[model samples]
Target: MLRALIYCLAPPPPTVNLVSNKSNVVRGKTVPNGTVSIKINAKVYMGRSDAKGLFNIKITTLAAGTRLYVTVTDKYGYTSKERVVIVVDRIPPAPPTVDSITSKSKVITGKAEANATVIAYVGSQKIGSAKADKYGKYTIKITPKKSGTSIKVVAVDGSGNQSVGKIVKVRP
Candidate 1:
């Protein structure tokens, strides 16, 4: 006599949002009473889902662009397909530092987070944009404006996070 037992595959994959590097917890949903596991670098973390299929697991801080692998295992011991999550940068760079600008000046120079994009604006109109070098130095060419005119400079990181704007006044 041949006996056959049917068993379902692993629990459905969990759902999670695109997380930031600053995130310290991973939350998601899967099969009720199932187990969820996360792998980051060489570390693995495990947690059980609630009756509502929700799970929250704490993790150490991750650097931007780090990858996390998640899986859910049903009571039958079957594991679901692996899910990949990537960490992003959510922290903005510091405001740019601007050198003194005179009405006769033809360029704006400053330092910001390395490789960040620097944008200069006069009111709502953008004057110019430049990318900071590895040394955090940048220069933007612009036509000389009237003395006392105010220009705003901001630094944007690779993740599109903008820093606070710095105000620069055109000197006589």
Candidate 2:
């Protein structure tokens, strides 16, 4: 007597579609049978597509002009592709320097990168702004709340890139 056996198996899943947006976000479409995983800097982030085959992946902001390696993999062990994205930033101006107080004056002067924009902030309020000269010199008139008032100054480049903030204390 001869015996016959029957076996059934499913075919491989569909390929994943991926796209990276300008705002540091990645979108993709995946198969319903599996979730999508993104790897960056040795860290793996996992997610799945919806019924409409849509997915959104959010990535952290990186330093200006930096690069991040990213890849996408589906549940069925299918990987779409590896992508390298450079962090896009305006590259803020250098920190500004507050000149020594030779006298008590409302005009605050500082040295910054040439052609930079200097903005003074007292707490959360913006006191004023000044444009740096060709020599990297900037001056802005700020109303002194009082002696010992803490102030923060930031420089902005023409491309809207902002520099690291510099802190200075007001003294009489």
Candidate 3:
């Protein structure tokens, strides 16, 4: 009598985590070292995964928001699922510019990222909120306070990213 044994074999799918940093940089790593590539409009940036399957590639300054496609090729010639990385305008709109501050009227005008949320602050108290128009202009009304009181206007993007505060000394 003769008997035969059968065996089954297959490679596991690799693991990958794509991350974006505060500096607007994206980095990713794979479970197993693999080759990676980032596709731009008509260009490709390639990098080889390290022993730990980690790699980073800095995207050159983009003119505007861009969509990035990344893929990793494993040692076994298997490619990872494609990932789409959306690089929004990470750059917080410029710090709000205090164009005018009328203490008596309790109104403040400023310039910020167009359509950004602008808040008028009195110390820790939030007094007024306005959305900058397309031209990055905004006029917010708040309550009048003591003279010499310092008020600040801060702009925040849709992503909840804050901009530097524009401080003004109220001459109430």
Candidate 4:
């Protein structure tokens, strides 16, 4: 008499989760489509954002301290930006680092030689970018999708130097 033995092997499905800094109601409704892409170490994971800005992507394999990159695009203009240094481990990643910001009505004088670039961010989401001149002057016209939002700005030099500034509150 002869007997045979059988073995079973299969890979598990990936797991996904949504991440955000703050939760609030916009225009009398909740924003749910703020999801971002997550990467494990150096591998890209399949994920997507929901209508409420929530995302939960699963991976067949996962490792600790995986470096993650999150990016969201402006629905109107389709301009996209990626946040650097986003890490994913057993714990969630820290908030985005804000450098500097200024919100004055007389900052821009309708000049054409402005060379300075203004980068704006609300929490971890990048809202817009602007340019200034040699006099360290810039103007950014921001129309927030939601109410009661705040943003930060960073002044970057041509030599790759970043100067920290104050945070500005936005009113709808």
Task: Compose the digit string of candidate 2's lDDT tens values, residues 94-133.
Answer: 8999874323657779899899899989899998999999
- The runs of at least 3 residues in candidate 2 whose Cα sits more than 4 Å from the true structure, single-residue gaps closed, are 1-89, 101-103
lDDT (C-alpha, whole model) for all candidates: 0.91, 0.66, 0.72, 0.41
Indicate whether candidate 1 or candidate 2 has the larger TM-score. Answer: 1
How high is each candidate's TM-score? 0.91, 0.47, 0.77, 0.32
Which model scores highest in TM-score? 1
Ranking by lDDT: 1, 3, 2, 4
Candidate 4 residue 63 C-alpha distance from true site, Å = 46
What candidate 3 gets wrong by more than 4 Å, as runs, is: 1-25
Instruction: Itemize residue pairs with steric clashes in candidate 1.
Output: none
**TM-score of candidate 3 versus the correct structure, residues matched by position:** 0.77
* Best-to-worst TM-score order: 1, 3, 2, 4
In terms of lDDT, the poorest run of 10 residues in model 2 is 1-10
lDDT of 1 by residue, 37-95 (tens): 99999999999999999889999989999999999888888788789999999999999
lDDT string for model 4 (63-121, tens) is 33333454443233232344433222332222223323334322212222235456667
RMSD each, Å? 3.1, 11.0, 6.0, 18.1
Q: Predict model 4's lDDT versus the native.
A: 0.41
Clash number for each model: 0, 1, 0, 22
Candidate 4, superposed: residue stretches over 4 Å from native: 1-114
* Tens digits of per-residue lDDT for model 3, 1-172: 1222111122233333433334334577764467787887898888777898777676675644566778877776656556777665555767899864555766788789988999988889899999999999998977776778788889998878799898888774
